[model samples]
Target: MLMNTPKSLPVKVCKIESDARNTAVWVKHIQNDFEIIWILEGTGLHTINGEQYSLSQNAVYVALPGDYHELLINPGAQGYIVRFDTSRPDQVDSDYHTINESWLYYYFSKTPVLRLDAGKHDKMKNLIMLMEQESAAYSSLHSEINSKCLQLFQLYLRQHIELLSNPSCTYKMNSLLKQYFWLVEKDFKTQKNVEYYARELNVSANYLNHMIKRASGYPASYHIRQRLFQEARKKAQYAGFSMKEIAYYLNFTDISHFSKFFKSMCGISFSEYKREELKRAV
Candidate 1:
């Protein structure tokens, strides 16, 4: 289950129009914040978490915190992109809070892409334009207005998400897995044990392992380790921190142990991984 915490919502909006002068080609990176990409025109390919998605006009894609995405836009592909930090707040409206929590725990956990109808697309586009204006105005109430706009945008997304969700699926199992993944997304950097997660979920370790394996085809520990490896690999490739510093930041006991773990899981040394990543960027 997702936690309810009050926090300020920080939102940033921008418009991208891909044409002769400005076409993005193979832009790939991991984001530290939540991102929503609303495609307005043309076609492209958007790959996230190693999954390729065909991007047509009106196709929306979301990248949650720690997700890696690549966008290669064809000429004339236009869209609005919104980035927001999902830091928990001290307080928020009960209804909005519930929706937000559900979104984090359920909707996004299911899929990163949502194709909107014309009406929904226009509504989202208008809201995003308003948010861009408010953000640029920098008035005394700019932050408040932007927050409200973002909440409205999220509500629209929630409605479509609910409509699109499959009712025939095993909801109980889905909920269990969503809760497990949510916990891993939040704590994987610091905690790496399946037992800890099982305890938090109020189930025995064996049962938790069984359920996760049954649902996802991987043991519960696999998800935890995958999350850790994702972060470690991203940091190793992109961040300026040294390997020792990266290991310490990720709560590893020492540099040697971290190196061994990385090689065992990833089949490459830290230096080799960085070298390959840099070459790919070029």
Candidate 2:
């Protein structure tokens, strides 16, 4: 059961479970805050942003504001859900603010879920259990402990990305890539050039491109273009803005440039893509 959290508190953590086999409740929930779901033991179907994924043990999902998610767990399934409002700068702790700049949060906007190995699973499980316990009791130190635990959780995820995600990636390369990705994410809209990001990362454009290409099988420019394309697709699919407005929203100089870029990246015109998506929806 989820705990009753005071509205004033910026962070809340609680345990979650599936109901009886015959009466399980699965409801679509909109993410209005930053949320993390850690499934300790569960076989379920998780629908996130209209895409369905199989939910298994040691699976973790991060949901940003505006994401649509729903979970249907089988009988006896258990998990933990943590919700924190980072929108309120003053209410959120400094540790959480640090996490906002972390690679885990940067990755969340792209890859929402990660499957943990046994050792990582146990470590996160213990941290989550401790958070649950702290959340259960109201104390003067409760908020501090919870904030510190959240920091540890972020550290673990960031460390996992560095140490486990790619075995061949060296520490220096991993650190550089993290900085590079973060920079691109921060400035992709206004600065779409790979040289700009390379400059910000303090590495030569060719070396940066080489390392990023080696790691992701795409050059640095590909990431920037992909990020812009992703935003364009999202706006086209969901927003009420027209192509011209979307072009302006993405800081494009003109509609024709936006259209050409869209066609090149998607292999279809913007209008054609939208029409196909509409037909599929219907």
Candidate 3:
């Protein structure tokens, strides 16, 4: 993924790419833009924000903006990658950084990996292929490609609800509460601090706390623990990584600290989490 400029991002409305094979995608650390990887064939591993996973054929992984992740693609693996900018509609200077970042991270984390039916997979693949062909043709109807891309996105949403049976919404924020909830999930690891978010929103930490608590019947810290637990589960999925490696990889202050954090969040040690996750994977 490249982040030369904000305009380079073709998200918010539409984005299209085709035949993405044999491309060594080592770029990470993006300030803006969201990304979605739809695999058509083959297998590869992706490290998102320091966690890693093995992506099989015909699967999808959605990445939110500001997340620093990279991919290790194998030969012959092809997919369409998309990045959406959250700040597009919401002006950057209109609000505080912490509040904006929290909401941004929240929606960004909503995109979960989905395995689609063969027919659905073929449909998306064909749409991507057509977009590629249009790019090669260089027709004057350039807007057509963009329009087709939007159509493809709609079809994707349709399949997302009908085929996959996932009820999660896409891109747009439904409410301010839902928005901030997701942002905390996406950025808890890097930031680890939530009060800064309240401050940035120009509100008291107690106000943010009371708002999240009253709305969700839980404190804002719940989202922090939720994200940390998710990361711990992910760490359990990868093998051959030592305890210390996992700790540092997860940005824990130290092994002891990570152990405490894991236990505090999950009621188990890292080793136990790994064992359980492996058994579940099997």
Candidate 4:
């Protein structure tokens, strides 16, 4: 019988190599962390967000924060389970941040499984092993070494995942819209208007807005505001930065303007939101 697991786990980076079926207990929990399960030798069932995936040798499964997942490992199944807290800024590299965002929006947003070929499987295995070794060594530089290894692992995994899952563009308009969304994610902080993005993509503003709305049910300006507001909310949570500093960071003309924008979009004053967040944390 499966048991309910805790809602959150302690923040850390750790790896375990196991062949034991008892590891299935991990699947019972929901964590506010990202996990990568590399199946070196296993045959079982993996489910994420109510979707079932066949677990087999050389397959990898990724779970994002708050995503419910389960693994039923059969007898004799073996694998490496790696987990790291997504909320820890000190442990995450900037490259990992970019890749994580891309994965969240592109791949993991839809599918959580990546089945790699033998060569790629072996390469990833080697990187995980190196990370495991460095983690166990506990040397003065162990954290740095492990972080670098994880960066390489993420880079390789993303490249192969893209190759495997690249969507066939049946319509050129779909491809163009995807490019426009990518640009919005990359430049939302400094550029918030549809005209700027349209000019950068070499299309007229009217056509660009039409295409984006047709594809995503939202206009291009909506995406820009959404991304900027997300960043603002994140920055607002940090106690170190004053509201004025956050407003400047997000390119708002003034603190009052930023506050008004935040309230309009988020339906709450910035101070009230932060206070609620603090209360929840306490």
Candidate 5:
């Protein structure tokens, strides 16, 4: 059964199982803060974002924050479901699944699932069952058990990325677009205008903007200013350097100019932004 968590949930490590020829519970459109499902016995089907994935007894399913998913199983399916909240910035034991949209678009363009080989599946099963037993029986060494659980969790992710990466996929790159992203991704916060990047990339500013928007769905200027803003965000704090020094480092001619630019972009003075971030961190 999937549960709704309106907040990011901090889950330690735990596993639950539904056995075939034993129990029947259909998992429907529920959002989880963090979920990892591993197939143990039979086969089943899962739908995430309306994409259906076939799952055998060795498949691992991952539901990141705010993901909509539903589960349907045949008569002879068995598996384990572990739900936890770890990506939240604060508080454990709280689940933040309020929305029904996925944040994975920033990174993962496809569904997040991993199917393991039989040998790896057996190893995962052992770790999951052991965590269940230790958590079920309280002992003075609870932290030790938790550490082991996190280790197993890491092992799962390592295996997942290894199998998911297709070396052949790199050949599919749109060269000009790839270069555009790399240029902006490597230098977004310090430069905020399209014309400058256009000069460096040797394209006219108009052409650069068009290609950037076409490729990344964001304006080239947006990427540049974003990069500059990122640097401003970092330097507005702890850089005992005077505002003038910060301005010059960012290639601004004068402190007043930098201040205005920062204010225009961030709606606040650099000092104010730094103070706010510090307050939040504290």
Candidate 6:
């Protein structure tokens, strides 16, 4: 289940170290703020911006604004969800060298999940815990601590630049998937063809499909459809547009075509999915 919480703070920390209620089943949507999820224990799957990352102990997942992501955790999980606004200097210092001057955000934006060993994970968790305590006080010192802790976190990430950034096998496949995902996010609404993506990547459709499947365990077509479905689901649940208007906005030929695709991807009609979500919200 999903829970709605107040977003008044510059930095908010929710701990799941002892209780399951702290973790929420996040639905697919474009992120509106920065979120750092540090898993101290548990296993699950995290899908972010059309890529999937296996979740294990000490795995950290970062979600930036404009990225589509969903989190599914197995029962008995433990973690911390750290959310902070980028625009607020108190929460995240814009002048931080490790974050902006060193171009660490590029690496994070390209690949957001990082795997750490036990010792390093504990170090990162300590910072998160400090932020949590400071957030409770909401004093001037809290802002300073937030800046220092965030900068320290990014510095740590810069130290392990090559080791944990991609988490994939080869550099070549990682590069291909990154470009492919970027293109899909940019044009999934109007261009749903795998061949179009392949052409843009300067590879043949078959080779693109093969590499994507070998890396992500899903074909190029599946990723394309996943992106489309993500946007469709987000609109159906949150947008004010009618079904027909949504179809037109998504570049569907008509509502009929959109309805069929929605059913095939979602396993139910659009209205049915909305009703189920509404009941859960209540």
lDDT per model, in order? 0.71, 0.73, 0.57, 0.66, 0.56, 0.70
Candidate maximizing lDDT:
2
Which of candidates 3 and 4 reaches a greater lDDT? 4
Query: In candidate 5, what residue range of length 10 has the lowest lDDT sum?
Result: 93-102
User: Please, what is the TM-score per model?
Assistant: 0.68, 0.76, 0.48, 0.56, 0.47, 0.54
Candidate 5 residue lDDT tens string, 1-282: 322222222334443344446544455444545567776767677766446787777667766544546766656665677665444424322112211111222123244676576666667777766665655554666435644564566455554554655533321225454555555544454555777678777889898778667645666776566556555644565436566777887788777988998899889887887677567547
lDDT accuracy of residue 250 in candidate 2: 84
Residue-level lDDT of model 2, residues 223-280, one tens digit each, is 7897788777766765355889889888999889999999999999999988876775
Task: Give the winner by TM-score.
Answer: 2
81-119: candidate 1 lDDT, tens digit per residue:
787665644323443434444444345545778878777
State the lDDT of candidate 3 residue by residue for 40-101, as single tens digits.
66667787655677878777775655454677666666556654444444332223233334
- RMSD each, Å: 6.5, 3.8, 8.4, 9.7, 14.7, 8.3
Better of 3 and 4 by TM-score: 4
Q: lDDT by residue for model 4 over 1-282, one digit each (tens)?
A: 221122232223343334454544444444356777776775778766446787788877887655656767665666776666545556566555555544444455456887777777777878877766666556677666766777778777766765654343212234466567657656777887899989998999999988777655678788788777766765665556677888888787878988999999989998898887567446
| Runs off by more than 4 Å, candidate 6 | 1-6, 17-23, 90-92, 97-104, 162-282
Runs in model 4 with CA error above 4 Å? 1-23, 165-282
TM-score of 4: 0.56
Which of candidates 2 and 6 is the stronger one according to TM-score? 2
How far does residue 226 in candidate 5 sit from its true spot (Å)?
Answer: 16
After superposition, the stretches of candidate 2 with alpha carbons farther than 4 Å from their true spots are 4-10, 21-34, 64-76, 84-102, 105-111, 136-144, 158-164, 170-174
Error of 4 at 27 (Å): 4.5
Residue ranges of candidate 3 with Cα displaced over 4 Å: 1-9, 12-31, 90-112, 130-221, 224-282
